[model samples]
Every structure is written in structure tokens, then in C-alpha cells.
Target: MKRKGKRKMLIAIIILLVVVVVGLGGALFFTAGERREARNLPIGHVNFKQLHDGTYLGKYEGGMYKWRANKVQVTVSSSKVTDIKLIEHTEKQPTGITDELFSRVIQSQSLQVDTISGATLTSKAYLKAIEEALEVAQE
Candidate 1:
């Protein structure tokens, strides 16, 4: 009788562990899917000529779970993207990414620039925010 009881308890513990592991795995899979989706988000072509001269604020709500959400203040002057300021971001220090990416955008005067290596998703999110700010400037 004692052996049977112990066996039953052991089986229950094993089942519980399996269920926990499976649940955690499923959650991670879904979250990863969303993260990947954010990376693939399309960046639209922005015509600098159409943008008005002003500072506009914009934001990308990141992915489904907002892990990469960010905001930017884009300055347009003389029909050019003069500057891009990182107002808010998820990174502890996004200076490097923003410096490189924003300079590329300013130099090109477009949002179709290549994303920074190793920070593709972050680049896209920031670009999206800049796009939004430009869209507002156009209006």
C-alpha cells in the first residue's frame, strides 16, 4: 500500500513538471513569433520633399507585446530630414544604434535606409516612429 501511494505521488509530480515545461515552451514560442514579426515590418518610402519644416513626434508601439516600443522626434528643415532624436526606447542605451541609424536617415533623407546590423528590429521600430513623425509633418 505504501509503495503504491508513493508511486502515485511521484507520477503526479512528473505530470505537473511536464505540464509546466510545456506551458513555458508554448509561451516562449508565441512571444518569439511576435518578435520576429516586428523585424519584418515594412518600412515605407518617405519623400523628403513632401515633408513640412517642423519637429514632429512619432511612435511605434513595437510588436504585439510592445517589447520594442519606441518614440522619436524628427526635425525637418528646408525639406530635409535634419535630425532625429530618440525620445524614448526600450534599450538601456540606444545611442549607438540611434546615432548610426539616424545619421543614415538624415544623410539619405529617406526611411528606406538599411537597418543597422545586429539591431534590425530596433532599427525598424525606430524607423517606423520616424516614418510616423514624417507622416505627421506631411499633414
Candidate 2:
């Protein structure tokens, strides 16, 4: 009787552990999917030409679970994007990813550039920051 009781308890504990592990895994998967969806959302365009020729500070916090740029400085000169500086960011990717995105923005003088393939969330956040900064320039 004692042996049977111990076995039953052990089985119950194992089942509970499995349920907890599966639940946590499901939660993580759902959160990751939500973040991916947020990353894929449209990055609004900003017409650099409409912005004044000056430096502007922009900041954007991505949706829950997404990467974010806490602060960005966008410099506009002669109705063009002259520089993009990431002042603060929460991206874990290397700096090269940021540089590539900044280069695209400067080259196109617009926010409608393609996102970095592997760092889509960071790219979107950077673009959103630039757009917000340009919006400030317009005011």
C-alpha cells in the first residue's frame, strides 16, 4: 500500500511538471508570435523634404515584447536627411544592422526603406523613431 501511494504521488508530480513546462512553452511561443506580428506592422513614411533643415530628437517605444529605440537624433540639411544617430536603443543586434538602416534612410531621404532582414524589429523601431523626430521638425 505504501509503495503504491508513493508511485501515484510520483506520477502526479511528473504530470504536473509536464503541464507546467508545456504551458510555459506555449506562453513563450505566443509572445514571440505577437512580437513578430508587431515587427511586421507598417512603418509609416516621413517626407524628409517637408521637414526643416535642423536636428530633431525622436523616440519610440515598440509594442509590448518588441524591440525599441529610446532616443534618436535625425539631422536634416537642405531638405534631406543628413544624419541618423541612435542615441539609445534596446536592440540586441550588432551596430552594423543599425548603420545599414540609417544609411538607407539617408540615401532615400525617406522612411520607406526596407527593414534589415534579420533585425526587423529594430529596423522598424529605428524608422519609427526617425518618423517621430521628423514629425517634431514639421511642428
Candidate 3:
């Protein structure tokens, strides 16, 4: 009787662990899929003239669960970034923090912005996605 009780408890523990693992995995899958989708989106091939003489819109996304989206519609002239506009800022994870960090990225086209200290991964992911978006819009 004692042996049976221990086996049942062990099985229950294993099942619970599996459920948690599966749930976390699903969240990651969705997050990654969203990011990949952004990369594939067609921006209509921004002409060099448009990039330098007109404006274009672009977007970025990064999050594990309850993602924070970033978008910047920028204007470039003479190979220099002139103005940037935020389309939708869904920074659901860290409130207003990511926006501030994004501001830093704009000031200097480097993710070495502020680091965000603890949310390092989130910051890097956001920056990378933005870089990808910029690459698309410029190309």
C-alpha cells in the first residue's frame, strides 16, 4: 500500500511538470512565429529615392508571452535618418521602459543603448527585430 501511494504521487508530480513545460513551450512558439512573420512581411521594396527623399513605415516585435511591439516609420534623406514615427507601441511587459530604451537606439543606431540592465534579452530582441525592419524598409 505504501509503495503504491508513493508511485501515484510521483506520477502526479511528473504530469504537472509536463503540463508546465508544454505551456511554456507553446508561448515561446507563438512569440517566435510572430517575430518570423514580421521578417517576411513585404514592404513593397523601398526605392532609394523614397528612402532618401520620402518616408517609409516599418515594424518590430519581441516578447515571450504578452509581447511588446515596436514600430518606427522613418524618413531618410541623403543616407541619413531624418525623422522617425512610432506607429504602435505595445510594450506590455515592462510598461514604459522599452520605449525609453528605444529612444536610446534612435539617438545612436546601436542596441548598446541603455541595456535595460535586467531585461537584457528583451532589449536585445527588440533591437534586433528593429534592425531587421529597417533592413526591409531600406531594401
- In order, the Cα lDDT scores of the candidates are 0.89, 0.82, 0.58
Question: What is candidate 1's lDDT per residue for 6-31, written digit by digit as tens?
Answer: 99999999999999999999998888
Candidate that scores best on lDDT: 1
Compared with the true structure, what per-residue lDDT tens digits does model 2 show for residues 44-107? Answer: 7665568888899998876675456468998888877899898987767788998999999888
Question: Model 1 misses residue 63 by how many Å?
Answer: 1.1
Best by the TM-score measure: 1
**TM-score per model over all chains:** 0.77, 0.75, 0.44
- Which rank order by TM-score, best down to worst? 1, 2, 3
2 or 3, greater by TM-score: 2
In model 1, state the lDDT of residue 74. 91
lDDT per residue (tens digit) for residues 1-139 in model 3: 9999999999999999999999999988867765665444432222333333456666555444335466656655676555555556665546455667667765664434555776655555565555555565565
List the pairs of residues colliding in candidate 2. Answer: none
Model 2, residue 125: displacement in angstroms? Answer: 1.0
Model 3 global lDDT (CA atoms, 0 to 1): 0.58
Q: TM-score of model 1 relative to the true fold?
A: 0.77
Candidate 3: stretches off by over 4 Å: 1-53, 61-66, 93-99
Q: Give the Å error, residue 61, model 3.
A: 4.2
